[model samples]
Target: MKKEKTVTMGVDERYSQWKSMVGVLYDWLANHNLVWPSLSCRWGPLLEQATYKNRHRLYLSEQTDGSVPNTLVVANVEVVKPRVAAAEHISQFNEEARSPFVKKYKTIIHPGEVNRIRELPQNSKIVATHTDIPEVYIWDLETQPNRQALLGAATSRPDLVLTGHDDIAEYALAMCPTEPFVLSGGKDKYVVLWSVQDHISSLAAEAGSNVKMGSKNSQKATESPSVGPRGIFQGHTDTVEDVQFCTSSALEFCSVGDDSCLIFWDARVGSLPAAKVDKVHDGDIHCVDWNPHDINFILTGSADNTVKMFDRRKLSSEGVGSPVYKFEGHEAAILSVQWCPDKSSVFGSSAEDGYLNIWDHEKVGETSGSGGPKGANAPPGLLFRHAGHRDKVVDFHWNPSEPWTIVSVSDDCDSTNGGGTLQVWRMIDLIYRPENEVLAELDSYRTQILGTTP
Candidate 1:
């Protein structure tokens, strides 16, 4: 009991220190307290853009207690433009108070606790969700009617369902970038693929109509259309933890599993893996992402407390695969890793260590910024660390429309008296912009302030 108290106090102290540095470290930050923990978070399409700020649709899940039904939330968020938020205002957020920038726009009482959420790249309003079941539920946010998440409320119906997995697919889910295709991995040691092309035209038409067609009372909801898998690839010997589709091809994708294996598949060929890498990590691989900007690079995060970068061209089907680089920074198992949409060489990783680290592979051998021995001991490619969350960051997503903006969630129930934490933040431009450009801007500011140019 005493040790637990000490640990809690340490976390509190660290949070206090982070709060003190918010103005210096972040250009904008919004802290919203959640009534229940969210296992996943994602950014939807940009809605309205103005001179100072833009409104966007944000998707989140509420894993509620039995007193109320679990819900998939659609929120409207006002994102402040770059260089617009004042330092004082950005630093004044209360950890316990909700931010004014976020407002709940609609709610779909989910059939189960939403474990993960992914939006289709081709149609942002179309989203896929994973629950504690083998089937994947699809929702068209625009056409779905809003419902209150009341106690004993009937769960909202899904627009479509993808069925193939023999066991529960609790977390691993992805949507194809090039087509209306869906990928999922599960405990059955199989990766399933389904194409929603046949349904897209109808969904698009309904979304464009701007009218709700479904029954509001979920109890009387009609049966949703179900689709079977186009392919079921078998390769992994254990539970498949995550799957990702290649950026340029709907037929190409990858899967990582608890067997410590990474398998690549091309649907045009066969149901078997085109290439397999055994023992990709010493422990179970939890997350995987293919770089959209540079298709050659792929990232995998695992229980071994490290992230590995693999070059796809070097992989082979006959033997163990080798990684190009191993990033050893997190103190605990990494839960998520995503390549930055804006930069090919840059990516972000979140872990059980309560940190979200941004890394740049291009800066691996660069001299430490501090030019000190202690700084030299730091990890090679780590560029920045976000330590605002007081517990494990379960999920985070980079906003593709807003440069460098991110939305991260933490399951802070044990530390924060039972509620979770949601933080949306963006680091200052000087931290990420080119050094020469920043220097020129600083010189211009100096000329205005002191009436002298440097």
Candidate 2:
């Protein structure tokens, strides 16, 4: 108990220190308090772009206390542009108070606790959700009527259901970037795939209409459509933890699992894995992502407290695969790993240690003097550490529309007076910009401040 208390105190101190440096470290930040913990978070489409700020749709889940049904929340978030927020006022936020920047737009009373949410890249309003069930639920956000989340509310029916898994598939979910395809991994030790090509036109038509689809009390709300898996790949000896489709190809995808294996699948060939890497990690692999810009590079985070980067060209079906680089920065098991949308060489990893670390693989062997974190013992390529969350950062997503922006959620209900913390932040450009460029900018600023001609 004493040791645990000490650890908690240390975390509090680090968070306090980070809070003090927020004005200097972040260009923009919004801390919104959530009423319940969210296991997953994903940014939807940008709704509007104004001069000072942009309005975006945000998707998140509310794990409720059973007094009210769990829900998938659609929220509108106003993101302040760079240099628009006053530095001194940016850090002045109350932990328990909700930010004015976020407003609830719609609520879907989900059938169960939503474990994961993934928006289709082709149409952001189309989403796939996983629960403590074998099937995956699909929703058309534009057509779904907004419902008030109250006690004893009827569960919102999904527009479509993807059924295949024989056991609960709680977390692993992904949507194809090139097509309206969905993929999920389950405790049944199987990876399931489904394509919504047949329903896309109907959904698009419904979204364009002014009529709302259904109400909570409507029993004749048209029979919900259901689809079967196009392919069910089996290779993992244990539960598959996460999955991701290749950015450019809907036919190719990959999955990581508790079996410590990484399996790549090619739907064009067959359901069996085209290439399998046995024992890719020392522990259960929790997350995996294929680089969008460089399709050859893939990243996986594991229970071994490491994130490994692998080149697809080197992986084969024959032997244990070798990672090009192993990032050992997190103190606890990593839960999420995602490549930055704007930077091919950069990525972020979040873990149970209450930290989200940003890394640039291009800076592995360079000596300090770069703008990244500097220490003799610092892990290779670590650029910055975000210590905002008081507990585990379960999930985070990089904003593709906004450079260097991120939305991260933490399951810190126990520490923060019965709720979780959702933060949207972007580090100052000086942190990630080229060293020479930063120096030149600093010199220009100094010349202006001193009232001297440069």
lDDT of 1 by residue, 1-454 (tens): 9999999998888788788888988888999998898889999999999999999999999988778898999999999999899989999988888899999999999999999999999888989999999999999888788998999888888988889999999988999999999999999999999988645444546456432323243224367867789999999999999999999999999999999998999999999999999999999999999999988899999999999999998876584678999998898999999998888898999998888888888878887632111355668887778889999999999999999999999988777767788899998888677789988898779978788766
Candidate 2 residue pairs in backbone clash:
none
Q: Give lDDT tens digits, candidate 2, residues 103-145.
A: 9999999999999999988789889999999999998887787
Instruction: Give residue 151's lDDT in candidate 2 (0 to 100).
Output: 89
**Per-prediction TM-score, please?**
0.93, 0.94
Q: Model-by-model lDDT, in order?
A: 0.88, 0.89
User: Stretches of candidate 2 above 4 Å error?
Assistant: 200-222, 369-377, 448-454
Scored by Cα lDDT, where does model 2 land?
Answer: 0.89
Top model by TM-score, which number?
A: 2
